[model samples]
Target: MSHHMTKNHPDSPNGQDDISKNDSGNPTIHEIIDIRLSRRGLLKGGAGMVAGGFMSMGLSACVSDSSKTATTAKGFSLGFTAVAKSLNDVLSVPTGYTASILYRTGDPINGATPAYVNDGTDTAASFDFRAGDHHDGMAYFGMASGGSGMDLNNSSRGIVCMNHENINQQFLHTAAEAGVGFSTAARVAAQIDKEVNAHGVSVIEISKAGGTFSVNTASTYNRRLTAASDMDIYGPARGDTLMVTSYSNAGQKTRGTLNNCAMGITPWGTYLTCEENWAGYFKRPASGGLSAKMATAQNRYIGSSSSNGSYGWANPTGGDTSGTGLYDRWNINLTGADATADYRYAANTFGWVVEIDPFAPASIPRKRTALGRFGHEGAMPAPAVAGKPVVFYMGDDSRGEYIYKYVSTANWSSADVGGGLAAGNKYLDDGKFYVAKFNSDGSGSWVELNIANPTISGYATYAFANQADVLINCRLAADAVGATPMDRPEWTGVNPSTGDIYITLTNNSDRGKTGTTTGGKSRGLDAANPRYYSDLKGAATQTGNVNGHIIRIRESAKDHSATTFQWDIYLFGAEAGADATNINVSSLTADNDFSSPDGLWFSRAVPGLMWLQTDDGAYTDVTNCMMLAALPGTMGDGAATTITNTAVPANGNANQTVATIAGKKATTDTLRRFLVGPKGCEITGITETPDGQTIFVNIQHPGENTALADVASNTTASFESHWPDGGNARPRSATVVITKNGGGLIGS
Candidate 1:
């Protein structure tokens, strides 16, 4: 049975001292979007079913008193509603705060001639060095004064590194509008170049003066590492025959990072950007056909034959068979005389963490092969402990995937702080990667993936040739090691003050209720993935952890190197009212209700301050996705609460409870929803000023619901969310800064 609830647990100060407090003594402000009696609460109070699966809880309240109690007790007072909206428009913040478009899709880099026009149609050559689309994970690293590491605390100027996740094909094509001409090779090449430029991270120097920040566009540090950029593969996996290609004489280094998602920064001052959902970029020839082994591998990476090629790179005229090497490289189907003749390693190059030095413009980004490749969501480093090995946590984003950690071979040292890439070479180039196996009895282990210790070679389940092979095909190795499967792990954040790690398991529709026979691959409700419920929008309906959960993992020794950890469900996500037995894992009230927890972060300024962002399809009926802030108690603060699976009746009652919070119900005293977004937008990626006075947050993909044809007009207004515009206007994902009128630490 799952350890659903904790019973009278002790409150140990494991990672507590690490939590930051607001030094400026300013009160925080909170605004509640909706308040009502929940349908589940009504059902438990004796209500019957209603039509459309939305059991209405009478509008009897407005924000829970529990939320106010939690906030006041912590000395924080929520602030004004700076950018409320119904129509799709860019978000804006309160006065004294300002925001500018630092970079956007098709923004030119590399000192190119005829700068980007901001239109969709940019040439391939111009795009080879331009900014990519869909900015996701990012980091800000302060540069040392005099170009040396001695002035580490100085923040005069810093490198701003941001990830370009993916492209919007519907927005990219002019022909799709005319519906006459087809996408050609040149068009595909241009798209590929733009996408490549966008995939990896862009490092640009940003400086602040007079309370405003601007990018030093011409700074020598400005560089875009894209899909076509040359990147060296390091670690035991480097130079493996599987990584060989006609382009690489050494059979190791390869081109580009793709689908770069969330990121991590090392203690040594290097950036770690991860690749996710990279499998759809290529196509295999149908007639020639891939060999059995090759097909299996290809299918494992990408999907089945029915999956359409992204960017139309497969069509001959679209560049799949052009005389230029560009078009030919996308064909992963066995085409040439041998592996060396074609780009068999094309898929192999992506899905690994690419490390770059923000200070070194001339240095090439290295794809660290030691961190076993998968659908890498993000890599988060534990606080550097002196004389101890540095630990990095990661998650595979696919459903039923695994959580992973990599421990550096060398121990931490104060000297490594400013070492940059050289420090990465020492710590990250070689390391031990382990996968987590969470037990139901409130304990977990980090199963090592070392080939020697794992005896992977002798394992009968799957064949492993060497360490390189093990790292290259990490999922198989993880399965062999019996790693616990998770529910679509996404971004991860660590409480800088407390060592607790927070992971977002976005959502899994195919879980629990779906009777797919893929045993270990298809999962049901367990302690870790307790919720199993469905939600409704206007017409769309979704189920199975429809709302997600935030899981906090605490190392047993209060150190990241420890093999054992204690974990607890920090929050359960749902609408104001839903099935209490399934959706309300932590007994959350209306003030803190949410769904599909995605972008999660803890404040660098305030140790206990946690920000939760939602990327949801389940609760669109009430509002769009949103962001919430919480002052969470540590892992051992609450008693374990039992969670029952109402949707999947036969799952047989898995138990879960708040282990440490004695005499406390899952109420607003613990969590509160802070901000909600406009229609069809995911509120994500938040940062604060060094003094904690100013806050910067991103509102991504506004007007995402507007059709391609409706691009000419302000379609977002019809949907009732003209956010930054406040009226009928187009919506663009933009960052906004928030600062108190009195200029003090935020959320104090």
Candidate 2:
């Protein structure tokens, strides 16, 4: 969803393009100028942290020197100084590190296809054989050779699967020079075909021959699952009446998966690629008057949009199927009268957690519907323990949506390691969906979303027909059960060392709206989602948790499958210039303050090494989105702080004045900004080999804010930043490998 913050693409004639999946209603939050720190406080705090001033230099040298490098009390450490915050148009890293392009958009999956020309002329047919754009959540899996030279955790030969969230249309064709729109109907149709082929996940075989990793395009393991690939639908929702469509009459299959964002690697060796922000791709006619039930359900999942879609593929003009070809199926509104007659039920087929067997190139992907369907972010699993149920923690990824957990009905067994979808059936097909409810006492409960629950069964407005209905309308069901609505929840990660679960609650400007606080129309701040403040970034005013925060929960006794858990706010994002006590809750200085914590991962290879990434809109005025490394402590390591609101009117439209309370805070030594990305890009999708020497990270849509007119120009000066492929090349979304200077483990 970070890509949503960028400028709209020129070819998007519909203006239906939405990068921030959902918009905040209040849009702007009021900042209290009265809360400013006094002269002495300013000299000692926030502004004093900035360099160049005499006292600041003295304070910076003495106070921050001890915390500048990433070091853990447990003894593992980072010797490099934090990467300097940069306005330069290139990737920035610590001095000893190096970054190289490993794979990029349109890179071939086979040797038969040549390298990308970077000039928008790559053929549409060739796209299916190429890598895709906006690289996101990915994973590296070791392939055991079972011979003399290789072991179970072999670092040399492995597979890398990446989620291609969506396409960057501006870079797809020869500089949109004559105007941004297409020149011909044929060109438009062909471009749409290419875009569809680039909208899912890329599975490439990578091998290290002379200590340098490269894509094995000729390897049979390389494959792509684009928007047109055939896929199977699994779980109780598989053949449900609501899922039947002309594309899959038996309700067992669907065509393609789109808007793939975050991901998870299953214990069975398959990869779970999540379908995110997928609803915008479909065009549903308002006049269709789809059933009351269908309308309610569809709205809950996809929400509502004004345009047909970013691309009018479903309702294209000219001769393809006379506007009713395989592409026409994207329009989900009623057309042919019955469910199986047309693609009226097409939208239901997506918004799923698609499972891909990275090892089996020919195996079709399956949509595990039991994971529930909202704007899914990622499906992060806790470690699989023998005799215990496998658990996956997930976030809904919308403003004020609920966090969730899926507990498998079946117990875990090492025997199912490579079982594939059959393993999915035994473990994922049936599970208990639970929503989180944080209480005042620093404890929380997982409110079950079971169809039989009284809260769901007795809900009068939205009928709960079955378990499938509850999962299909998960947001509605969570609301019906009174689950806590948090700021936008994105990625979830489980600490490999301590088993604490952490979720990135990206900024939500809608949280403290006129009538949305606790005593008001909507939910208010709780212990887990404590601070609710406004951010003022150059003339722009953003309120209601504008900088976002990360919350970590330790399941009861560290049992991942436990129903009740104790939670605390691990870190709150803020600007280095903001009020230290109010916004800079984590006590951050200019070196590490960040906003919109999006991608997070706990390194399995390097214990205690956690990587934090930013896909932000709030802090762009100060710096580009960045990636950070942290040595996180388990839950309850810091004291809880309280929040008070003085601007509340007696009418109770906003947050009312409340007593100060304490909340969880991270130790300063725990988190530090490791790398900052280039201009107009988000730092996302991270993976490292088992040995922890090579880390793969994605830099998405760099130079994305350039004007369409600039994009169409002949001079390279028209671009915001030509990066990765420097010297006038169009900015391309790519994955890079980060290696230490002399083969030391990452974050060391």
Candidate 3:
């Protein structure tokens, strides 16, 4: 989610409030000694290359001049000069590469649809045939030559399935803000319809030719799944009473997905779009008291709120003539006779990993509830080993939330490569769910989140009725099991060679901050979230670990089903010139410094190569958000260390010394900045072609800082940045295709 969307809201300027109360004496990770240590042998050895399943497709003769930076051919190495930190209104890349727009908001999906005007004049009905807004997580599924079925190895033609996380409200309406054009008492029905339609997932066809990629607007597989589309609820939570709503009285279905952030790609050629920040879309009035069970779930997920959702989507009237209350379903209040008579249970149907078949555009999406929903960032699956259960790693994106994983009951089979959602039913529907518990000694264990677990079975705060209840109210179950509360765990990525899981803790301002308590426990300093410092933002000062860090873990015996693992803080994010003793723990230089790591992905074709993306608000004064290329080491590569955290002025706290495990510090060889995005945008959602020569990245919410009042004036000065489609055009969220000038592995 974009922090710029809620910059003026009551919550922190960082998009979410820390809502988890996991104060069980857990430890946070910290670094010490301000060291600049590098193992030159490791970079030359090229270890983990073949192990990561990469074939030596030697560089093409057409390789660009930038590839001359490759010092050795042993393992995967970054081959381009790091792009300098930039504040320009355009995307910047290395000298020998190009970043061109691929698909953009309101781009026509089919030949019948007209080109987007982008003047806040597009009708609501047209959005179903056009591209949605705010593109987030995405996956590219290769299609057969005839555009009929899956072709996992096809590099030239494929289907790009992406998430439209949300809308730039000011640009979507004719009069900028919602209440400007229509009634002051309620939102305009047409504007609300257009906004809702613009939020969901998009499946479009794309082709590559002459070293350039473009959307295939006339392809048959192109389609849009909006907020009004039908979806089937699957897994243990299906048909549960808590899921009943006016739209689905049987509780076996729900309307559509919302706030889709990160993503995952299945071996069977399907897309897993995660639902993050969905709780903030429902309307729950404080005047209407909730049932004890309902109240516990609502408060735990969304916190206590007396107002409508972020956009007040339910404030509009007279749009539900079919008696299903299409506009009214956004409200979660208990009205009318019972659950079936109203949308009180609508919130329970969201917060899941929805499975969609990009190859089969006519199929209905399935909400896989077996994943145990709680602000799902992404559901990244480990490599599917034969005769072993398929394992998927997940992270809850809210502050103080827990990390989760699911192991399937059935063994993996290569024959199911084209199984589509049928493969999902066999693997994702019935699984054993778990939450991670990190220990102070660099070791960790997974706590099974089953209804039969003693801690969950006998909980006193809110009794879980059954397995379904436990899945719906997963945060409560994790709380009961004493899962480790992390620093805003956002994305989980599995190493292609090592079977290790890497998670991004995108900064938690509440970590170790005084006077901030939950469940009678204060969020103090610990090993897993060690830093507690302050940074000045204009006139205001922000505290806590504002720069964030990434942690990695390896399953015991390289088994995804293993309940035990080893973990370490892989890298710390800080400014290049910050205090090296406490803040710049990673020993970063100007070439590779970054803050707020959000989207992370491992290249399938390049083996050990990994890509990192940022959604930052803390470092905007220096540069826009960016993406980086890195070759990481294994767990426990660095020694344990201790650091002292000085208290922020005016914040009530004292200096505290904490010891934590630190991985090998980043170096110019192991990490380097690759691309810097446009102004007021986040660099998220990355995917590469089968050959690893071409890659796609999403730029979300460009020019988002534009004032609503200036939107209707229609001038170039009204926007913070005019990018992708330059000149005086309104800014749009879009996907850019990056490639070496000629033909060579990207970053090679």
TM-score of each: 0.82, 0.88, 0.92
Q: Which RMSD does model 1 reach against the true structure?
A: 11.5
Query: Which of the numbered candidates is closest to the native, going by highest lDDT?
Result: 3
Runs of candidate 2 with Cα error greater than 4 angstroms are 1-70, 145-152, 176-187, 304-306, 319-324, 516-523, 645-668
* lDDT for model 1: 0.61
For all candidates in order, the CA lDDT equals 0.61, 0.72, 0.79
**By lDDT: ranked, best first:** 3, 2, 1
Q: If the candidates were sorted by their TM-score against the true structure, best first, what order would they fall in? A: 3, 2, 1
Could you tell me which 10 consecutive residues in candidate 2 have the lowest summed lDDT? 54-63
Candidate number of the best TM-score: 3
List ranges where model 1 is wrong by over 4 Å: 1-101, 107-116, 128-130, 144-152, 173-188, 285-292, 306-308, 316-324, 453-455, 517-520, 648-670, 711-731
Comparison by lDDT, 1 against 2, better one: 2
Supply the TM-score for candidate 3.
0.92
Lowest-sum lDDT 10-residue window in model 1: 6-15
Q: Write the per-residue lDDT of candidate 1 for residues 415-498, one digit (tens) a residue.
A: 877787778889987789998876654567898897786556666544677888789877767767666667678788888767
